[model samples]
Target: MISAPHKSSGKTLVSLGVMYNLVQEGFSVNSFKKGPDYIDPMWHRLVTGSQCRNLDPFLMGAGNCLDSFISNSDEKSFSLIEGNHGLHDGMDVDGADSSAGLAELLETPVVLVVDSQKMNRGAAAIVKGMQSMPPKACIKGVILNRLQGARQEEKQRSAIERFCGVPVLGAIPKDDALAITERQLGLTTIDETADAETIIRNVGEKIASCCDLQAIRSLFSQAPPLKTSQVKAERKAIASVSIGVFMDPAFCFYYPENLEALAKNGAELVFINALEDASLPDVDGLYLGGGFPESFLRELSGNRSLLRDVREAARSGIPLYAECGGLIYLCSAAHYEGETYPLANVFPFEMGFQNKPVGHGYLDMKSVCDSPWFAKGERIRAHEFHYSKPFDSSEIDAYQFEVLRGFGVTGKRDGVLRGNLFASFAHLHAVANPGWARRFVALASDYKVKGRCAV
Candidate 1:
């Protein structure tokens, strides 16, 4: 597993570089990300030409996390798990959801990527401290990043290996041109990057020339294998129901398990790209997930047919579900970059863009009003990541959920309801909420039979 002393320490870049380089050498690689990230995995997928799965220790417990890792990763392929943030940073001071905790759970050796910019011996102290930190991290190696020259690399590498007792597996020199662009969120998604392939190739060649892949492979081999449970697929009553999901470069933040859950509950999944398609198919209902709608507001606004279709669906009382960016799309307009862009306009609210995040963490919520999905007073555990706010606060008071923990649409509340529509900033992972899929499918089936007029 690849980890770092802190965020922006070239963990994703190094992992991508190594992955591309390995693929160049004809190795089938399966990559995994250690947190609730939808973007980084896209870059990994572009590099490896395969789906990159997320193995979040917090969203899924250690046992289920390990099982997920085993389930998604190919046994014959090389597995590369990348950790987000620092190895020890978690939800609380106890470090319960830390990368180190996940690594220890899988018995995976960690290769700490220490950023060597503007420091040398101090890097060793960070590694040494991490090695002895509680949860007892097994720091098997180190990768020195942002080195100046051969002399600096030798000094930093030697100091870390000498003091921390972990070998420096690689050294990436300081090159501003090599770094990926970043905004309030992390790096731009792979599809958004124009020269992503070229960038990955260049970085991969550089990492291949610098890093010892054989040693990295040895460290991967040291991880103890996780035992996965064999649960048979259950057939359901609504086998013919097809659930439409909005998926594209604009809105593609979906958990693989979420789609699988819908499938397991006997719903046929159909993906529609709002940026391209003009209308939803004759499916039972729609599922619009969270993603970077703000980045493609003009294109989304230009898609008038799709906008009209979604609005018509809302007016027809179709059972529809939306989260975060999906919620932004369903609003009257999205105000960003000093301009207003017309979207679905299904609800009576506008979303105002913020330069910084309004909500960014785990959410504990309770249904404050009756919605198509959740009942009143029903508790929910989900996550929120957004940089926009509901522009009309007075209008938003009619929404459903009250935040018990973590911020939401109006600091304490979220989930906008219009007819059978359910829109919220909090994203629910179906793996964590198995009933989410069942309930959503049931709504779609009910819509197909009796229509969602009652909802």
Candidate 2:
């Protein structure tokens, strides 16, 4: 497990560099992300060319999360688990579901990534506290990031090793050129960055020179073997339906397992670029996942022809499902920076934003929509993080889910309903909720048979 002192401490950069280096050593690597983030896993996929599965204990429970990890893992290939935020930080005060807690559950050794910008012995104290906790966090090694000079690196490395009794595996110098850009959500996707292959190659080469590759590989080798059931096997697709997905950089927040679930349920996904595409493809249903639509408001609004096509698709009874940014894209207009940009204009409400996060957490809800995806009162668990909201609150009175454990679209409910369209801020994981993909495929099958949804 690759963990950090806190968020933005370059844990992801370390993981990326290390994984790329490992792959260059002729090792087939499988990657796992600790949280519900989409962008980081995308980078991991770009480096490894394999699906980076998500393992969220809070969402899937400790046992199930481990099972998912093992089930999705390969015993032959090297596995790297990239944790979120700090090693011991979690959703609640108790830190029950932290990355450290997850390491304990899996009995996996951890490699802590530290930013040594203004830190020295203080780093030892932090890792020592983490090591001395009642339930030890099994922090094995350290990777110092952003070290300035050779003198500073020697002192920082000596203090952390002598005081904390852990090895300092590597020290990366401060390089502004290595910095990745960010928007409202987080790092820009690998798809957006230029010369991505060369960038990843350089990262790998640097890490291979700085860090001890053999030691990192040895850490994962010591972990318990992946169970027979945990190892995935080839399965033939069983369902037959075409599903159109808004799959460009603007709508690129899908979990790898989610796509796997849809494929297992026999879905043939047609990826559509919302920014440049002028019309929806001939498909049974449409899926719009989450991304930074606000950043490209001008481009989205200018694509009037695509918007009209989407609006017509909904009217024609296409089974359309949308998440956070997708919800905003389907609305009449979005308000940002004192301007209104027209989108699909399918919904009556206008989307607006808050200066801060309007809703962010694990969402617990019960379905109230009489739709094909869920029976009335079906419970669902999903991840939610958004700053945008609907301007008209009462307009969502007929939404599909009653929010049981989150600040939904209106604090009490989410999942807007309009004929065959369902839009919301909650992002569901397909692995944790396979029923979601199954139901989606069933709906798509129905729509494919009739060329319209059955009201």
Candidate 3:
């Protein structure tokens, strides 16, 4: 496990570098990221050439987290898990849901990445504090990042080893070339970055030159063998149904498990490039996940044919679902940077952006009314992070979800229901909401059989 004392401590970049280096060494590395994040996992996927699964203790529970880790780690040469935020940071006061807790649960030793930008001796103090903290993760080694010179490196390395009793595996000099660019939503998607592979390759080369590969690889041996659980596939409801997914630069925030679950529950996913595709494919249902749609306003707005096709599909009562960025694209118009652009116009409200997040954090919501996707009175544990909101907040009164915690569209309700369309700012995970995939496929099947107005 790769972790740090706090966020922005170079843990993510270090984790990616380690994965890249290991993959270059002819090892089939399976990587996992803690918490609900799409950006970091995308970088991991790019480096390892495999889908990086998320292990969120808050959403998936401890049992399911174990199951997912074991199921995905089969027949792999190595497995690397990246921690989010600080090692001991979490919503729980006892630190039960922190990355350290996850390390303990998986029985994996953590490699701490300390940013040595300011002080040398202070780095060891932070390490000592983390080592003695409750739910202390078994930190086997430390990597000093953003170092200045040999004097600073020697001091930090000696202090950490002597005081904290942990090996200093590496000391990386401060280099701006290794930094990844960021936007409002975190690191920009790999699709949007033209030199993404080049960046990963450079990072891998640098880390390989600095870090001790042998010592780091030995940490994998320290982890006890996890008890494997039997992963049973959900029973297929229908033979098959086609589900169109927007998967371009504009709308690429999708969980791998969600796509896998859809396929497992008798849905053949038809991936569509919203920016390039002229029109929608022949599919029973459509899914639009969260992404940076605001960045491609002109390009998306210029695609009139595709926009009309999507608007027509909504009007015809096709089972369409959209999340944060998807919700933005479905709006009649979007105002960003003093410019307005037309979109699919599935809904009547105008979308507007803000300097800060309108709703950011784990979301707790209950179904207020029955929709094609959810039943009334059913509770859902999901998450939402969005900077955009509708201009007419009153339109959210007819939404499906009653917000129990965290801000929703109207600060009270979410899950906008119109015809057979269910759009929301909340992003659902298949593992947390196990019935989502089956229900989506079943709805699509019903629509296929009953034609327009099937819901």
Candidate 4:
């Protein structure tokens, strides 16, 4: 388990760098993230060529944490877990369940990353505290990040080694290019950055040079082999339906497992461009995953033909599944940066930006009415993180749905799902709830069979 004293302390960069270098050295490495982060894992996947699974104790139970880790592991040589937030920070009154807690639970050794820019010997105190905080939490070594020069690097390295009683595994020089970009959503989605691969590779080399790769690899030597139940094949083929997946830079927040599950269950995945594509791809279903659609609202709205195609598709009763940013695009209009742009009017709602009512966090939802995505009375667990809300109540009335847990406009349960449309502020990770993929494929297949029969 790789951790740091605080956020943006180069844990993610270091993780990627280490993983990349290891892979280049021809070692089979698997990657995992500590929390419900979709973007960071994307980078890890790009570098290691393996899907990075999320392990969040709060959203998922402790059992889920172990299950997800074991399920995704292969016959790889080692598994690297990139932690979230500060080592001892989590969502609890007494901070009982932080990333450090997760490391302890998994019995994974913690490689503490210390950002040693300002202080000299003071860095030792921080590392000493982290090492002593939980005796059970195994802190293997320390990596000094943002070291100035050879002289300063040596000084900081010696100070940490002498005072902290831990070997300084690495010392990374301060480089602005090493930092990843960020937007309102989170780190800029991989689709938006043209040089993402190059950036990741360069960052990897820097990390490889600074850090002790041999020592880090040894940590994984004795890790217990991962075990998981083999996925049983479905007795019957799920209906085969065509699903139009939004693939532009603005709408690329889908979990790979979600799409993979859909295809495995017999759904045809068709790629669509919301920014430049003229018309929607012919399909029985439409899926718009989350991203910063607001940033590209002008380009999206300017693609009038695509909007017209979606509006027509929805009118024809094509099953549509849109989340957060995608939901914003389905509304009558999106108000972003002091301009209102027309959108695919699948629902009558109009989304307006607001400082208040920022919906966020783990959500537990139960279907109040029967829908294609979920049956009536079905309970689903997901998460929500957004800042936009429906501007008009009348528009929300046009759609029918309720939120069970989280900040929805009307009450605790507020999301607009009407007809075959499933629009909500929640962002779901498919691995956490494999049923989401099954249900999505099932819905798409049903539509395909119905369409074929009608034709």
Task: Output the number of the lDDT-best candidate.
Answer: 3
Q: Write the per-residue lDDT of candidate 2 for residues 1-455, one digit (tens) a residue.
A: 99987888888888999899888878898899998888889889999998888889877777778777777666688888999988888776667688888888778889998888987667788777778763467888998889888888888888889999999988899887776777666788887888777877777877787888788878887886544343456485865998999988789898877777788889998999999998878898899999989878999999898899888888888888899999999889999999999889888889999999998878999998676666698888888999988888676547788899987798889888876678899998776676888888887887888875333
On the 0 to 100 scale, the lDDT of residue 86 in model 1 is 95
**Per-residue C-alpha lDDT of model 3 across residues 102-126, encoded as one tens digit per residue:** 9989999999999899897878999
Candidate 1, position 79, lDDT:
91
Candidate 4, residue 31: lDDT:
89
lDDT of 3: 0.89
Worst 10 residues of 2 by lDDT: 225-234
Q: Give the TM-score of candidate 4.
A: 0.87
Q: Please, what is the whole-model Cα lDDT of each candidate in the order they appear?
A: 0.84, 0.84, 0.89, 0.78
What's the TM-score of every candidate structure? 0.94, 0.93, 0.97, 0.87
Q: Which segments of model 1 are wrong by more than 4 Å? A: 227-239, 452-455
Q: Where does candidate 4 stray beyond 4 Å?
A: 93-97, 132-135, 148-164, 225-239, 355-357, 364-370, 375-379, 398-405, 409-411, 452-455
Range of the 10 consecutive residues with the lowest summed lDDT in candidate 1: 228-237
Better of 1 and 4 by TM-score: 1
Off by over 4 Å in 3: 233-239
How many clashes would you count in candidate 1? 0
Q: Which residue pairs clash within candidate 4?
A: 239-445, 403-413, 403-414
lDDT of 4 by residue, 1-455 (tens): 88999988989898988888889989878888887678898888899887877788776767767776666665655789998888987776544457887887777888999888887878888888887775246788899898777887787778788887778888898898888898655677677778999999998889888788888878776555444456444454453677889987788777666787677767878898888889887798888888778779889989888898888877777778888888888888988778999888777868898764477676767677766676677666667777888877564553334566676544455556666777777776665666777777776667766662211
Ranking by lDDT: 3, 1, 2, 4
The candidate maximizing TM-score is 3
